[model samples]
Target: MPVRSPYPDVEIPEISLFDFLFTDFGGRDAEPALIDGGSGASISFAELRGMVEKIAAALAERGIAKGDVVGIFAPNTPYYAAVFHGILRANAIVTSANSLYSPGELAHQLTDSGAKLLFTVSPFLDRAAAAAEQAGLPADSIIVLDAAEGYTSLHDLWGTTAATPAQDTLPTDTAVLPYSSGTTGLAKGVILTHRNLVANLLQIQQMGTVTGDTRILAVLPFFHIYGMTVMMNQGLHANATVITMPKFDLPEFLRIIADHRIQRVYIAPPVAVALAKHPIVDQYDLSCIDIIFSGAAPLDAELGHAMGKRLGCTVLQGYGMTELSPVSHCMPDDRPDLDLNSSGFALPNIVCKLVDPETGEEVGPGGRGELWVKGPNVMVGYLNNPEATAITLDDEGYLHTGDVAEVTEDGVFSIVDRVKELIKYKGYQVPPAELEALLLTNPKIADAAVIGVRDDEGEEVPKAFVVLQDGVELSADDVMAFVAERIAPHKKVRVVEFIDVIPKSASGKILRKDLRAREAAKA
Candidate 1:
């Protein structure tokens, strides 16, 4: 049995996420806000606030009005946070694109959301420019966010423009339009309102897991919502310093904690696997880490507990989807003897129930059923797709998560599987349908099925089991390169194995779980 909190139900607070960004610290000006763990570039709270205002004013000067869509296409940087708040402060929508996305992969998001402006870094300039051209966005609309030396700098926007007064951003106004595939389909833009983001932030805080005094190591990419909302937003709201990384390097990750005396770390299952098995993780001093929260993928309980023993920190797991402002449940650090497999109970103010997918009736406690979540954190719906939105949200407003999960008697929940055709690579959701559509464009491929296979990193990567047409000679490397060329780096097919036919049900739905099992057995 999982530990239960005896604290009575409390009324969930109604607040805007932007309010915390501007008003929380009461002018704590000189404190460190974001520090790059690699390069050691630090931004104080005063400078951060000033940059946000300048960026906001710059966008407004460009005629980007409320409800407009702005694309943020950069890795984790101080400029990234400033641009994000700038767009949201204008009551506009932010479409975050993974920096590793291929030109075509990025073009899809830019076109689908009808984004008017793009803020991107220099290393990605060529790819971003190609994506913009392919998406038909004009050249003037492309804003390069090159803060490093020898490039067009974001600082150029500051002092040239007066900081605009913060606009009236309401709770119902959509702030971030993060893309996610709902219940196994093409990736659709999820309409996350200010209320949705703020609600989940408050819910996670109420779990009594983290605090203002906690120092968080932020390695997860801020382009993704799990890191953006849970790690970055929550850390700043609590007045904690965010030590960020451009990419994951195990030794450097360890040293950041040692140097900064970091107490809290936010990660996904892949990081846990690294900490548990990676030999280099033992090379650094991690004596100061007090808590580790893993989310975005299923974590191995044995490995998590082992981490606790090795690092002397309480490691807990959280569960959520991109649709639920990315955090529906979290297990706190101080909790006693948490179950290794369960994702903990819903936090205060969240409503979760398991229902039969076909019948729509609530399942008994401890029975596996499709997970239905309802709360202020739930998104308004899929943007501009009425059918997908209708199928996802029930008439009574419960968002059908399409996850098969079972709840314990005391409300701890564990996800068995998602009843959709999406694969989680690290923490990013890769839609098989999108990959399948892309694979068909290859001249040598007659048919293809994308499935998740565990790699050496202990994280799942996309593997394409393909059926080559007669007289087509395609090597595994050739097929892999074909995918790498067409899709994002994370969505690239890591392994290519020739198959006669992709196993499918009578209705022609690809049986990916069976494919995953085959890979596991072979391993």
Candidate 2:
């Protein structure tokens, strides 16, 4: 069954990202495209245009064309954007890899996406090389971030003489392929066409969040759609400067805010938690920050207000999934007085409804049910996985967000819980089952269950509730150390506690909400 959109089939223009980047808004010869706070690096729109052109030409020279996948295994740098636009200019798909991913993690994504080219930074050269090799991606297709090591430099492509994209119009062309965080299962490739990207950019901006003068802190990793579309696309679409970071370091984040006089912040729940509870946050001058938007996880109203009170600004939270181009609802920048708990009104051109999971019937206002989203920003479908796509995005085009929420009569919505069992650590998805499967393999572990625990920062961290085997002594530290080596940094179980038995329902499913209640009571 084809997923149907709830939005009225209005004759909206299907503008391409290329058209938006180089034409309708700011074109090739505009002001600076990006600025790096860490290294004071800046690239003008003209330079960015040149870089994209070269990469497009280079891809053409390599026989890559429309629909080819290019893996960008790097951090949040100007080169990242250049390559992203470069891939789109060539009518190819851009799939991003988390810089912190191990070789095994990277290999899965590359192979799943069938990536033909890889752009990687120097720091993770070994991991990227291994991933490309493991995925059977040709060595010749591997392009090093730098040129000194005999690999092609994306920078060198900037000056090369070659024809610009032969196909300039890219309305329906697929531009980016971002994978699900795979918090529940295997990550699936999401095909976002130029129209998908452009519509989302417009939708975010239409929410009245920022202006051309706005300066956003680009701390979120660009690999995720939350950062890729909301941060990179929204920033560029508004002709704003993005301050890039390799990773989130508290001290550095504060310093960048003070240095850049950042006006807006787009961050995840973990970052917001740090701002609310971290002792060091008080020492820095965050007066310039006007708006802070937290997403990728549920943020309690109490914590959201605390951060706003401490920072003396408005704090907003959004709720959505990777399958929806990330932005479904955001606190309208204009409606700062709205309840902080609500994910806020749906963006323009988006229609959302709550349906009772048990009955599949639409729940009225103030009624709790699973969130169903419909908009142009919703994805085309999962790449090469029709079965999963059908399960997630229903026949009516209303994507079952797998999140439970209630919409008030005023149109504001607040999320109660997720129907899914995915745990979010610092805004990154960490599946409990995945961790449980890994833990059961340990000789000393008899039974294990993973649940989220809110730290002092008000962000959830993976905490293992375990019952060790008889005659085996497994310390909490031992359990923590075990997961650290096997998974990505965000997926590591930071806290471990002994539990005699994990409470299960009559059907033998772990009672996670009950566990959450117990944990909260203890806290």
Candidate 3:
């Protein structure tokens, strides 16, 4: 039997994403919705709703119909929320691409997602144009977020009259296609339906994290699932004033928190580390902050507690994946007495179980196993990859999370380790396979294996073990520089070790455990 959520099931409405968010905005129309952290510009709820409809009409005018995949390849801005909902309102799927992706990386996602159109900012126009070209998308298919000399601004798409596209969207229809590498392999599109996103939003709302009066500081990148749901959607759903920062600059982050009197902050582990130890934090007044919630990756208990003490606020953590519509377990705001290390109880209507990996049997309370979950928040499937979908979601609809966790007697879940080979670098996923493939492209490199190794800052980084070809002369800096030019900065190879061979199994799979042991011996 699966462990049910301690909380009662909340009603999930069978409605489209747009209706769920904007249907009851009459009273809150004049309220501030999204405030630009940099320029102090803002959009009222009324203006946001109108812009969403106009952008939808613009998309329809451009011949974008239902089921078409549209890509957003820009950083977080107040306009991002408008464009994202507009794509959904047009009955199309929005696939958000990382702003830091290189041309090649961006091209792969665009081609794989079968994106018919792309929305990007002017700063990324050069790479976006190159990627669009590589993906066989014409120049006209690209729209700039900010108006450029030859290109039209996204604002231009809005018309004075609100036009609603044909209402063909179902609750189960895929709404967002955020890509994830699942447990292993290259990144694949995760199919989150309208119901999946709405269910998770409702589930999170029941947790009582965000209230109507909550002032949120959103510095987390909207491209990632964590920020999309927690910071952007949840903040809007609760009618909170969300201050949007395009990127995370520590000094700016502190200043905004102080200036805006932000009450709630949602961040990842690295930022938590900074808050705990950074000297600059003492320079600012963060007294208004009520809660600091950390997700995306694990937060060390010691660091979490330290940060709470330093800021005089409640520090909490949550757990989820891109395939789970991003949140399954979170520390409820009402339950501040729970252990900071645990990810907290399963959200309402979510069923969680711990199963023995080798025996494939359910574990009792306190026994460790791969965490399996069944909930409305679980994704529909992986786009264009039925095999991966089948592997992740079983016939009974349970998602194998690939995370080894233990549930306490009182129903708290704590992640112990990962059963998969993917590395979490500062909350950003760095798949070893993606890095190894790039390493093999070098003429001097004969064979390579990549693994996550801890740096002095206690953060995970990709470390490459290279076996060079005969008579090849290459320095570690040369190898690192080679990869840095071709991939995103976060995925760059930070540490390199020359080895005689890359240990592998008989089936030719890389023995990462053996490599990890060797690294442990060195430490």
Top model number, lDDT = 3
TM-scores of all predicted structures:
0.93, 0.90, 0.98
Clash list (residue pairs), candidate 1: none
| Local distance difference test, each candidate | 0.81, 0.81, 0.92
Q: Encode model 3's per-residue lDDT on 1-523: one tens digit a residue.
A: 5889998998999998888998886377898899999998999988998888888988988889999999999888889999999999999999999989999999999999999999999999999999999999999999998888787788678743546788789998899999999988999999999999999999998887676788999999888998888888987889888999999999999999999999999999999988999999999999999999999899988999999999999988899999998999989987888888899999999998898999999998979999999999999888899998888899988999999999988889999989988999989999999999999999999999999999998898999999999998999999999999999998999999999999999999999999999999989
What candidate 3 gets wrong by more than 4 Å, as runs, is 159-162
Model 2 CA deviation exceeding 4 Å by range: 1-11, 25-28, 168-170, 181-183, 277-284, 443-447, 465-473, 497-523
Better of 1 and 3 by TM-score: 3
For residue 174, what is the lDDT in candidate 3?
Answer: 90
Candidate order by TM-score, highest to lowest? Answer: 3, 1, 2
List residue ranges in candidate 1 displaced over 4 A: 1-15, 147-152, 163-166, 455-458, 503-508, 511-523
Give the C-alpha miss distance for residue 346 in model 1, angstroms: 0.4
Model 3 earns a TM-score of 0.98
* Pairs in steric clash, model 2: 4-397
